[model samples]
Target: MTEPILPRIRPEIAALAPYKQGRQAGPDAFKLSSNENPFDPLPSVVSALQSATPINRYPDAAATRLRERLASRYGVGSDQVHVASGSVAILYQLVQAVASVGDEVIYAWRSFEAYPGLPLVAGATGIPVPLTEDSRHDLDAMADAVTERTRAILVCTPNNPTGPIVTSAEFEAFVARVPADVLIILDEAYAEFVTAEDAVDGLAERVYEQHPNVVVLRTFSKAYGLAGLRVGYAIGHTAVLNAARATGIPLSVTAAAETAALASLDAEAELLQRVAVLVERRTTVIAALRAQGWDVPDSQANFVWLPTGERTDEVAAVFLDADIVVRPFSGDGIRISVGEHESVEKVLQAAQSVVERRQ
Candidate 1:
């Protein structure tokens, strides 16, 4: 019998490795890898989910109600919002909507881990601009990297892995330099944890009002303690929102997730208070880490980064041995999520022991 022939696939798709999430080894272990909110979901949100009926039925395709709520909260019209399973899903859809074969997408290197893959999946070139020495987005360098083929640019404020925000002034100047036709995606997944006075405020509100090509993505996962529920939304010009919505899978977001997200918005004040506590814990941890002579950055997110280089593996191993799971970035650093006081203490103890042993 003749051998069966297989169809050829896109080269980029074949070359990509699956994205690995942070390690969570045991039920008892404190997971400080995913930068998730350590708090439990609000009582009201839980109640809303419990009371949700006919979950067997499909969710609204457009997620009209949740979009309306988000629109009102963000001071935008419902038509300008697009809801999805998560911010990542919205990102993928946005990329697909705008980018095509031979097009280029630019973002800061060592930012969100998912960013590099988004462009690859969309059949576009992924151009990662190296971050500044402080591990912040070098907006001028990113702008200079743009070519005629560039289709989109992604900016992750209070950036992932190394957490520092792009100030409002910096963002304004960068936006002025970019071409209007090139879409700018502002990923604000950690916006709630930011304490910087000059940090970009209501970026979606400002972008949607003034810049037609600017899109802001937000999530209910981080500050809202809804990571498990997986609800996120994007705000942009109505045209761009519609295009992103077009690329999304129908009913990708569940009815229960929508219910929880809506309820979370109602409980926003309480959730933000918890975020404040995490920020305070982050401050304490950073100071302690610096006192111990570790090279750390000024983090604006709910995580701390250690630029451990070749020692990243060692540091992660120490935490794992202490039953604290921290995220280790290859050849870069380790990111430890700020949990509650107890978890933070465990991390501190593990870090102290690791530093002492290394010395």
Candidate 2:
């Protein structure tokens, strides 16, 4: 039976499909559906969370200390750093602050799946530029797509699902073409997993310093294994960030999250060693997939892209039956994350079996 429809709901929001999270696997399966850090929580981080205070009170509204730490690390003032529950939340705030009815937000399609839905809720149109044949962003095409109606542009490095990164040269050139008034967001959620030397590091490169309109979004969720805590930060001009801050859900950040982030910072070295392992696993996955005759993209991030195209669903199911869960963009491809060390052989075995069937 058809569900009853609500009256007077915003048509755009009603039409928008909900953002999908990756599937979870059974206890016997390795869950590689989400690009999550496979390591268990560090002992120090756990201890810090256990030491939280003032459960009766709210968290720091501004996330003052976290912002200050980030600012110092990035060589920016505290005012220039903005922290939110997650980078995705910061994306929503930035979108609502800049785009509205009749405004347009441009980004590469098959990028972050969340990019399209963000503008819809903001009452803005989302323009999705097609990715190139190699599944990398067509920066030139994106620059050409910009118009007076364009309010913001999001560039994802080592882009989600598809693992290619935007080169520093292309990014610099694209920034040159974008109008100064249009807000540009570099969503580097997977920067820590990036091993390619040529890939643009949005925060480390400090693109925001030269372009006042640019903002960089990053999250500890991926590298630090803090997805459950949900903390992320942004670096940009204070004026632009203030606009996002105004749209922010007040006191949404928690003391536990702030403390956890601080503890993660303290444990950065150990966490990065884990990232290095994932990177090696990613390399092995790519090599194995290629040997199986699958044309995997050059993934600098922690995931590999299998452009299964029309076979996406079938291929995903094969992996599922083999006790491995993965994210499949139906009719397009599959995104298999580099997960636990034990999962490596399982993933390759599943992929090889699927490849044999195809052949």
Candidate 3:
């Protein structure tokens, strides 16, 4: 018999690799690779989850209650709020809605690990502008990269894997340069963790009011500790969000997730207290690493970026030896999440070792 021919696949899709999450750590090791909130879910969230037991039934495809709650909180009309499994799910929906084939999507290089891949899935080219020396989005360069084919732009504030935020002034000036028609996504997954006075608060600034093309993406994962539930929302004009909704899979946001998200909002004060503690831990970690001569970036998120360069793997090994797992970006650097307070000393010890090894 003749060998069967392989099914046809899109060359771009074939070339793309699946998204890899941070490595899981052994029981004895501190898993600091994923930037997850170290605290457990609040009692209210747990209680809410327990109550959402109608798993035999499909979730409300529209997620109306959660959407309404978020709408009331953000002071937007219900239509302006779109709910999804996570902020990342909303990213995919928005990209699919706006881009295809020869279109181009621009975002900062080494920002969110997901940004580059998102465009490829939409059959669009990804324009990754390099970050500045300080590991922040070079908005001027990104603005300059836009072309007639550019359909959307992703701005990951407190950029993931390299924690530095795009400031409000910089964002406003950059927005001024871009054409009015292009879609601008403010990816604020870590917004609650941000303590910097100058950091851009997309919702607070009401970006969409002035720039109808802009959408604010936020999540219950990082701050609300709802990572397992995978619920998030986007705020934008109803027309823009309706386009995204058209591309999305129905009933993607589960009832458990919606319930947990509402509970999280109810316990916002307590959850923020947890965020404050993590912020303090992050400050301590950054200070200790800098004192050890590491060129760590000023992180407003729950993680720190160490530009280990060629020694990325070597330094990561040092961390592993100390029973602390970190996310290393091959030749670029390492991203260590601010985990348990107990893990802080271990992180500093590992950093000190890497420093001594270089000497």
Clashing pairs in 1: none
Q: Whole-model lDDT for model 1 versus the true structure? A: 0.89
**lDDT for each residue of candidate 1 in 1-359, tens digit (9 for 90 to 100):** 99899799788888898888888759889989998898887888889999764777877888889988877877879998899999999999999999989999999999999999999999899999999999999999999999999999999998998999998889888999999999999999999988989898645337657878899988989999999989898888999988998899988988898999888888889999999999999999999988877878999999999998898897899999888999999789999999868887788888888789877
Runs off by more than 4 Å, candidate 2: 1-7
> How do the predictions measure up, each by TM-score?
0.96, 0.97, 0.98
Residue pairs clashing, model 2: none
Per-model root-mean-square deviation over C-alphas: 1.7, 1.6, 1.1
- lDDT: which is higher, 1 or 3? 3
Q: What TM-score quantifies how close candidate 2 is to the native fold? A: 0.97
Error of 3 at 29 (Å): 0.7
Tell me the spans in candidate 1 whose CA falls farther than 4 Å from its real position. 1-7
- Per-candidate Cα lDDT values, in order, are 0.89, 0.92, 0.92
**What is the TM-score of candidate 1?**
0.96
